[model samples]
Target: MIRTVVLDIGETLTRDDRYWASWGDWLGIPRHTLSALVGAVVVHGRDNADAIRLLRPDIDISAEYAAREAAGLGERLDETDLYEDVRPALAALRAAGVRVVIAGNQSARMGELLRALALPADLVVTSGEWGVAKPARAFFEHVLAVSECAAEATLYVGDHPVNDIHPARAAGLRTAHLRRGPWGHWWADDPAVRVAADWSINSLAELPDIVKAQE
Candidate 1:
């Protein structure tokens, strides 16, 4: 039976548009400018940090940018009830005797996000906290160690197939893929990793059933 559920934040439990929209709202910068800059950096594979510095040369770019990002996250997420479906799903899992957890690539802002969304996770694990990235064995290993959960009794859920599902599966944990976001179409075609999940659900609303089925 699955006793632990580890969730990834971005795309799985949160939306990317919220971040961009919040950034525009908090920074007083034009949304289109931010979009163009993001496209240049991400789509064109340009140096993102350098591009941000050059684009807004007049501002103390790093501090100002981080503050805006944080403020935007706080505004859209922390202050607002962002993860409405998430809380109930987690509560249901908790009620069913499943341990709910957050395992992702968050920095120091994780606490703020959790408090803002009022997420009902029993544990919080992030790359910022572990000083490593997901899909790396150490990340999952560290989480398992801290939680004291056996690999077989734990399940890891995320939007990315490799980062969230595949590695966890390899590590002997159950896996779920939330398949409706930017990374959705990227790896869906890879035959080796195509159907790796123990279960797949499109929304957080379906997660409780998946967890209960295992239990």
Candidate 2:
């Protein structure tokens, strides 16, 4: 039985295209240029932080976030930013007595942001809190420990093919490749990565049915 479902934040639960574009503007880079950097990072199998460093060697990520927070831009996620299917899917899962967790490779304020947005999750976690990030075995192990459930009885949903799907599957959890964001649309045709996910979903509306089937 799939007792727990852990979700990725960026492209899976929330849409951040505009937010990233704003960040690009703040950094004096064209949004398209910043987007290209993001695509390049995924294509080259590089980490997002490494790509940011390559783009701006002098910028400290923490300081940048602090600046944004001071400007009342960071640490805020509005309900409109979420995908349309997210709330309904989460509600269904929760109503069915499944534990839902929002655990992602996010900053320290992720839990706060989720709470501020009033997202329906039983627990929220971040790499900053856990001291490890996704695509790492330790991160998935930590998730399993926190969920207090066996890996085989858990499901992880995310937009990344390599970072999210592959690692979670390797860690013995079922994975659903949510095909909506950059990673999903870009890597959708990659046969190797495509085969790694136990399921591929274009919408979170499809999730409850998938969970039901599992049960």
Give the top-scoring candidate (lDDT): 2
Write model 2 residue lDDT over 102-185, tens digit each, in one string: 899887886677767777789888898889988899999998987768998899999888789999999999999888877888
lDDT of 1: 0.69
Please, what is the TM-score per model? 0.73, 0.91
**Regions of model 2 farther than 4 Å from truth:** 71-73
lDDT of model 1 at position 165: 80
lDDT of 1 by residue, 1-215 (tens): 77888888776766666666655556666777876675565434343344445456676754765776665545345434344577778888888888888878666566456655556778766687788877789888876875557988887878777677888888788877776555544444556545688776767778778766765
- Per-residue lDDT, model 2, residue 4, is 90
Candidate 2: global Cα-lDDT?
0.84
